[model samples]
Target: MPHVLIVDDEPRMLELLKLYIQPYGYTCQLVDSAQQALDLCRQHVFDLILLDVMMPDMDGWTCCRLIREHSNIPILMVTARNQREDIIRTREVGANDYISKPIQEGELIGRMEVLLQQQYDGLSYDRESYRCSYLQQKISLTKTEFELLGVFLDSPRRVWTRDQLTTMLWGAEASVDERTIDSHIRHLREKLRVCGFPIEQHLETVRGIGYRWTHQ
Candidate 1:
């Protein structure tokens, strides 16, 4: 199940959002302040964050900026103000999207779904163009490397044995070897490293098993 962190100062608003979100199968952790939210983010992995713009202590904008410094988790800011400047400011602070207060169930859910589907931490990939980017910096990849990275991100933390990956990417009849798979992983890691992502920590070897993708 997808995990979400909901940050809002208003107790009623927090509860209402939980009620609106829980039935859709998202598990949530609620914090009443942006500082609490930032602290929790460092310790937990969340698929998305619902951040309230008007908090008494640290505002959502500051929290979002701090989170972006170390994480690529999707952030959707919720605010009463719908001015164009406010919307632009959300993006400036690295929020993926924003929503107005008096949140409508349909619109809120719809936006959440879109962000969840596109959640890839800091990495963005274009399958058609074979383009990959980490934190807005371009990372070049061969078609095979691109496909390999796609498989890993598609199922984070699912360890794939060499044979499983070979069959899935190539075919049962294809004669790709285990070493070839290792090479692809190495190249992918190096590319991400060059783009300044700590790929070593997020991508792990399963010792005698295989490999999996993990995140902070």
Candidate 2:
């Protein structure tokens, strides 16, 4: 079973998360503060962390930063604050993903599964060189390209809308043109092609929808 650590200031919130998560076969450890979460991190190895932003003693952002200093464990920031700034800041502080409060158990579990699977498989990404592995060949990537590819590879065959891609690459507040996402995808596909990966076969457009990476 995958181990999960849930950090939240509210007891009810923690219990709710546990109730939802445990049924899905995850073993959960709960903590009420960021400091306690950090302490637990030092003592245990967890597959993922569900962290709340507005905790006492130390905020999730600080705790996230501190955790990243020593570990790359997948962290999903849970917050009632849905502002674009807050969402962007979660990424800045090294969270793998963020979800607003009134957590949807299905979406929460889906995100967790993605993060955990990516970590377990080491698919696409090479942390040491900041490169993406395709077949036996490895290609260097810009940070944006890397992140974009991560989104695709993390959920192969799932169509991601342009608006979703824009928000992902440039935070929700960013005013990025949809055309910009097209340009990035084009560039990313070209890089993969140059590296001998068959981009046309795998990276596909969905007419009015968006893009999907289909792993053959």
Candidate 3:
């Protein structure tokens, strides 16, 4: 069973998410605060996190941002805020996807299923040896980096948030910061640049949003 972390302040909400998701072959870890969630993330690994936007101490958006600073675990923001700006902000904070308040069981399941399947696909490949060459020099990538680039290569035009990279690459068993992923990307790009590779266009940065790989 895939381990899942459900971060919400409300006891009822946590219970609801657990009850709804348990039947789908997921193990749920319930927490009431963002701090506690982070504490849990430091040690135990979770496949996905269902985060609530509004919390007592630190809101889901802030928590997600902080979490992205370390791990790229996929976060699904569950919120009652239906405004466009709120949803946009959720994405800005590195949430892979967002679901509005009063979530339906079926809809939530579908989203979780899609995210989980994507993660599985990424892990299935031999991440260690997977490499890309630009120009004439060959730059080798670590398994995590390979998975990060895998998402980029799979969708060339898409910009992936730090959270997406963490979830797809690290999953629930390992630990690493999202910024560390940025470091690797920088190193990867630098290697490519020095190699006179023409594929640099594939690795694009979207300012505050995230990174994109757009090479054909």
Q: Highest lDDT among the candidates is held by which one?
A: 1
* Candidate maximizing TM-score: 1
Q: Which stretches of candidate 3 lie over 4 Å from their true place?
A: 120-216
Lowest-sum lDDT 10-residue window in model 2 = 119-128
TM agreement with the true structure for every prediction: 0.81, 0.58, 0.57
Candidate 2 TM-score, C-alpha based: 0.58
lDDT of 2 at 7: 97
* lDDT of each residue in 1-216, candidate 2, tens digit only: 678999999999999999999998889999999999999999887878999999877999999999988877888999997898997898899888999988999999899887775552223465456767654466777899988988886676789999999998899999988999999898998998897766787789999989998644
Question: Candidate 1, residue 176: CA error in Å?
Answer: 2.4
Model 3's alpha-carbon lDDT is 0.75
In TM-score terms, candidate 3 sits at 0.57
lDDT of each: 0.88, 0.84, 0.75
